[model samples]
Target: MNKILIIGAQGMLGQELLKIFPQAVGWDREEIDITDEKQVKQKIIDFKPTIIINAAAYNAVDACEQAAEFELAKKINGCALGYLADVCLTLNATLVHYSTNYVFAGDKKDGYQESEPPNPVNKYGQSKLLGEREILRRSNLKYYLIRTSKLFGAKGKSTMAKENFFAKMLILSTKQIELRVVDDELSNFTYAPDLAQATNILWQESHASGIYHLVNANPRTWYEGARALFDILGKKVKLIPVAADEFSRPAKRPKYGTLLNTKFPKLRDYEEALEEYLKDRN
Candidate 1:
């Protein structure tokens, strides 16, 4: 049996990995600190896994505005990814790393592809892109960079979907409900279970080692995404369309974070995936 090890196993994607790969070993935040290169290296040595999937990342969007956390993500996601790449090289193991589409600045009208050059507008994107570049640099190692976007899952407890910010406006039962959503921002929404399944489809095939844009096939504005989400929740929610400049935040969100995969059979359109997710959701 191939020993598969997953870091950040408590998160949305990680939780789905455990379900998809029943026998894999998983490490939560308490179990392993990905920031420490030495600890991660040692963990690999101890586990002696045949494949290592890193789902760990500093995903705090607002917090990434701080220089310290942004630097931390680079150290953990990039530096540590490099460290693990060396380990995989030494141990002769396969490595799968998760990345974000924020690597692209979304200046172009079309979606990002596996071949497009990255120009991240924020610190989070910069850090994750650096990680992708660092780990992928090792030619000898078996590595796959899976770039995904707008992930949500039931297993992910503290997700933005679970928040009431959008719900209050969507459910709109109370008179105090006043909501504003960005119409300018566009992205490909991905559910964690679907992403996990798609990743597994490629991971199961030994030859699937390369950069893949793994988000859902369709693109939607932030309002549409929220509307679909509220529809899934069975709450009556209406999103007031606004521009990117309407809401003031520390970091800038990508206007179009859609990632197009022209070749993957396992991936489907975002609308299809969303329908599936909402259809079965409780």
Candidate 2:
């Protein structure tokens, strides 16, 4: 059995990973601040884990646009990976890191492949891309970079500044009679549990050190996804489709950020995953 160390264990994905790998050691933000280089190095040295899964990330997309936040994002999302990778190098541990679909420009009609060139449109994507590069460039440790799309799961212990899209929509449904969602932005939706299962499979079966696209099958606009959720919950609301420009946001988003999984078996459909999540939440 591989000794596993899960960083950011309080977040949604991280929490799911803890459940999936119960014997693994878990470190939330309160336990170890990833940006603190000395702490990261010291923890890994003490744990001496055979596998280090970094589910921690600075994912505040809009807030990441500010100069101070940009630097913070770089530290947490970009520079910290180099530190982790360095420790992994010394310990001879395999590092598993999560990335986002925002790495791509989202201009490609057929969705992004692992081979596609990354041209990030926002600071968040740039930071994640930087992290990926740092892991590859700074260390010789075996690594797996898994890129996922829109994620939703039961809330965890982490103090996330923003809620997942599904939770946001559910909240909006109660407070407002009409909801407006961006129709221009299209991407695949990923359930955190499915992602956790896939991560385990990739680790045990593939064991190859490279980039892989892991997400729920099928792509849909935010509007379509929200509509499906409303239907499933038996909530009656008028959902209006609006362009991305109508709702102003701090950061630029990819118009089409869908990812294609050419490496692993496709997970369940987005509708099925959403249904399961709703049931679990209720």
Candidate 3:
């Protein structure tokens, strides 16, 4: 008899989560603004959900570097979690939040473990770190902090939704004969559907709530991933591997943000997941 509440249910991951838990109540930005502490508390209190899953996030990495956007990111990605955690404690409900591997400085070339310290190098990462701290600060609060990297799946049907890497690459391939992709930064790509299904498994199995890294196996660069996609589609696009510095941006990304899964079983390879996604897209 667990009543579940899904915040930010309109996004890509959130959409998959809704499909996985059809019986669960969902609230997107239109329905609820997580930044509004009072409103969030009131809404959750009224609903009296046994579990609160926060699928919302300020994921615009470059945009978050701007002062105004940084403040907004802080409120949504950071401060909002404090209120959510507070409400979870009050109602004795479990809070499941998604975090990013960006929380780490990406200094570890091999990968990061669940027990490693977080040292974010960018504003967006800093903001997500803030949310993690907010939840962890409350020792008594029942929560699950899932840290994942580059996610790819069906695009969300929301105006606020941002396109995933695979989708962007596909569109670019159709438009251009050649594409210049970054060769540096290495991280695991996660499939939204697989991650969603794993979330349900974690909940049903009653896994001890802590930090978990759920992502597809095998770490690779963006350039490599793009090449794989073109090969899969049999598209004749010349993918030129270039340094990350070639593309100037407001935010600095991690060089190696691969999140290693030590707790749960490893997921499918990103290439396999990507192939499935492309087939679905077609």
Candidate 4:
């Protein structure tokens, strides 16, 4: 069995990776801190892993809004990636990393494709994209960069862009819970376990490389997803859907950030994936 090291082991996706990688072996932050390159290098040297999955990320979306914290965010999101790539290269191990669809220009007449050039709308996405480029450019280690969207899990509900829009509508026990979900912002929600399984399978197969879009099969608006969320929770609420123009934020978002999974259609649609996720959660 191949030994695997997973950074960000306590995170939603990292936890999923631990469950999926029968060969996956590594720390839970109680064991290591990925942001520390010295520790990362020492751990890799000791584990002598065949595969390295980096799930560490500074994922707080609005945290990037502050100018003072941008550098720290870059260290966690980008520089750490570069360090991981370097360590993986030294060990001659396959390195797997996660990225977001946020890296793209975000405004495409058609949904963004892996082939499309990246133009991040925010500092967080920009840092991640930079990490992607740095890893590819600097490392000789075999690598897989899987770009995912709108991740949700059973743990603490965090606002990973569109998670709450749907989760919020689910708890609408009252007619007072009116949600003004943005119709203009397009997306596909990816469940973590599904993503982890698909990713490791692709990696294990030995032909997976370059950027692959690993999102749920269907494209949707936030309002539709929220309605689905409420429906799944066995609740009925008057969801007051609104346009993206109605809501304003510090960072600009791609009006149509839908990613098309031309490479991995066998993965199933967003609805099917969500159905499985809901079933597990319940």
TM-score of each: 0.90, 0.97, 0.98, 0.91
Worst 10 residues of 4 by lDDT: 156-165
Predicted candidate 2 versus true structure: per-residue lDDT over 177-226, tens digit per residue: 89989999999999999999999999988567989999999999999999
Ranking of models by lDDT = 3, 2, 1, 4
- Per-candidate Cα RMSD to the true structure, in Å, reads 2.7, 1.1, 0.8, 2.7
TM-score of 4: 0.91
In candidate 1, what are the lDDT values of residues 1-282, reduced to their tens digit? 799998878777888888999999988777887777788788788889889998888777767879888888788767878888888888899899999888999877788778899999988888888898887778888988898887765545324223222333434435636457788988787778888888788888764678888887678887777776677667765458889898888789888787888657646776676666656554
In model 4, the Cα lDDT at residue 158 comes to 25
> Tens digit of lDDT per residue, candidate 4, span 171-241?
55454656677777787788888888888778867866677888876778888887787676677677777
Winner by lDDT: 3
Misplaced by over 4 Å in model 2 are none
Residue 85 miss distance in model 3 (angstroms): 0.4
Find the candidate with the highest TM-score and give its number: 3
In order, what lDDT does every prediction score?
0.78, 0.92, 0.93, 0.76
Assess the local accuracy of residue 172 in candidate 3 as a C-alpha lDDT between 0 and 100: 88
lDDT for model 2, please. Answer: 0.92
Q: After superposition, how far is residue 248 of candidate 3 from its true place, in Å?
A: 0.6
